[model samples]
Target: MSNERLRIALARSGHTAASLAQQVGTDPKTIERWVNKGRVPRLRNAHAVARVLGVEVRHLWPTLNGRSEVSGPVGSDLVAVYRQRSDVPIETWKTMFDQATESVDIMVYAALFLHEQISDWNGLLRSRARAGVRIRILIGDPACDAVRTRGEEEAFGHGIESRCRLAHMHYRPLLGVDGVDIALQATTLYNSVYRADGEMYVNTHIYGMNAYGNPLFHLHRMTDNGLFDAHAASVDAVWCTARPLTGEIPDGSD
Candidate 1:
């Protein structure tokens, strides 16, 4: 549990070992021992130190909070947390965008941002597939009962169908590229996923609001009991029940 974090916190708080020792009711030598010798202190002392430093105890020592250190294939528990889907940083999205060399998978209802916000995203996918990167995109079936229900419940007008079709329009050119596949699914999805080979970003939906306002979780591949494979498997299951996109849209917008 002991690491340089204590020292760093003390530094950030502009408090020397002697001063922090005084604040936490510890001897100056004890503080030095913890900082220099990597000695972990009792919970009481840890709490006192964290209180003085204006940080949580877990922030200082993650293993102290009854949770063991996260260890798995990718060697961490979570990648990043976002309050909403848009809260995910552009750099992070670009990292996922530029990193996939083997495959890319997507399962979403109305991922308009992919085409509207991301510059030439589908075009890049085409190029990647042309270079032998397999890609699969699964969109919600607008004609399905679930999509109509979600739209009526959320009052998003009729654009759910339009957005899905438009997104497909963006990907239509990729149909000619080998290894690229697009489909429509009727699965009831609470979360939309964007996955590459090793990592994924998940956006959890909240009823009566749009998907953009939902919480997001970033997961990475791990050896066991990791969310990466679990979510990926869920997407695969939905994909299995999905139908291939025929580029036919009832919406005249596209």
Candidate 2:
């Protein structure tokens, strides 16, 4: 079968076989064979193509062994580690979002701090969307058992659910904006992920401590199946099962 993923990614990235081949230092016929004849490129070529396309190699070739593509030591993708989530400078968050040119994705339970702390959070998202950056947000479903359990675990009682609802309200303005999407997920998140292009911040969720008190990891994607890709896969999985926002919060029954 043809590599539809490659074909679609090329179209979305506005790259024809000739242009992609020119960048990757290959003949256009090779690219056409990779897409039309389903032939995988060499490891280096695959990595180069994925980098130029701004995507993970595994994303274009799902069955490929991502671990085999690593060229450096483990944890090479780690950029930094913050002792506490709150220890991450606000400016860092701003820079990440501001520098994103391709995509911004978030997965959280009640990241109320983002809206409360980031200056003009909604406006920033709108601006990114207007710039043609795709944004996908997956927040916890306020009425889901996962939220309730997490609230109790965090000693917040029903406050976690309230924050989820409030977060929904804060994101309401971007509901129908082009290139922006909001979804509600019921998964038990172990780490909240905030990604802008190839870099991301991962906030670890402790059993009894509030998220702000937990550790955070800053990772930049370096290989096809590295630390960054692992978290990104989790985010994608949750996003797949999430329900899209409809400009109205779901009642408990939902």
Candidate 3:
């Protein structure tokens, strides 16, 4: 679609119209015409533009993609793509975290409180790191060192030193790393995880709807590229200015 508003969005997002056009394999004048003339290109071109912009193809066609289609499982309700969280099984979380290859961003108000379950998660991180996954952790100030120390101390006690080490981890606040391609935000009050793949997300919230009062909400497989991209943007905005945690070992002893 050739809309000035879309052009503005692209400009504000650190992308130039010409670069975007080149990425989508379109001429600069074509992009200029679309922005200045409010012209809607063919569906295929629109999709190509959306892909280049890292947004959903339907962003240019809200009527079709905005509507909520069958998402999530039985029980939990579908609340618009940008809002609802997917309360999936713990196993699924592990699987998804394990599969994360390119980037991993997590924002948590509380550190991983399940230190007893540290081995599996630590192993996952180490394995991912070894495989070259860019991993980042964001935790509230009050919980940052407590979590790091707790996890490491626990690991030491169990003779699992390397697995629990946070030397390679980076800690910052929610607003410090906005614009990151893929990220997750975890809040204790309402535990939610936003796992992004491209612009789509497999948002899983572990909150109120667990099997036996466990802190798992419901699971939603949202394919809305626009909404997912928007969420990722929001997280990045918050992460951009948030505090950065330095000195991995807390005591500066490595």
TM-score for each prediction? 0.68, 0.71, 0.39
Deviation of model 3 at 244, angstroms: 2.1
Candidate ordering by lDDT (highest first): 2, 1, 3
Worst 10 residues of 3 by lDDT: 180-189
Shift in Å, residue 35, candidate 3? 38
lDDT of 1 by residue, 1-254 (tens): 34666776676577998999999999999998888877778899999997787654654665674665466554363555679988765655755655577889999986888877778887778777777778989987767777777787679867676776677777677665678888888878888999977667889888888898889877655446577877888988998898888767534332
Give the lowest summed-lDDT range of ten residues in model 2: 62-71
Q: What C-alpha lDDT does candidate 2 achieve relative to the native structure?
A: 0.85
Q: Rate the local accuracy (lDDT) of all candidates.
A: 0.75, 0.85, 0.45
On the 0 to 100 scale, the lDDT of residue 82 in model 3 is 35
lDDT tens readout by residue for model 2, 66-181: 44323374476665677999987686687668768899999998788888889999999999999999999999898899999999998999888989998899998888899999
Error of 2 at 235 (Å): 0.8
Which candidate tops TM-score?
A: 2
* Models, CA RMSD each: 10.1, 9.7, 12.4
- Which candidate gets the maximum lDDT versus the true structure? 2
Q: Who is ahead in lDDT, 1 or 3? A: 1
lDDT of 3 by residue, 1-254 (tens): 35544664475346676887878788888877777776666777888876555444444333343453343342122222433322333443454455555666565433343233444555566667677766655444333343344334334321222222332243222223333222222222223233423222333333223212233322222344444444555556656645555433232233
Off by over 4 Å in 3: 1-87, 111-115, 143-191, 194-225, 247-254
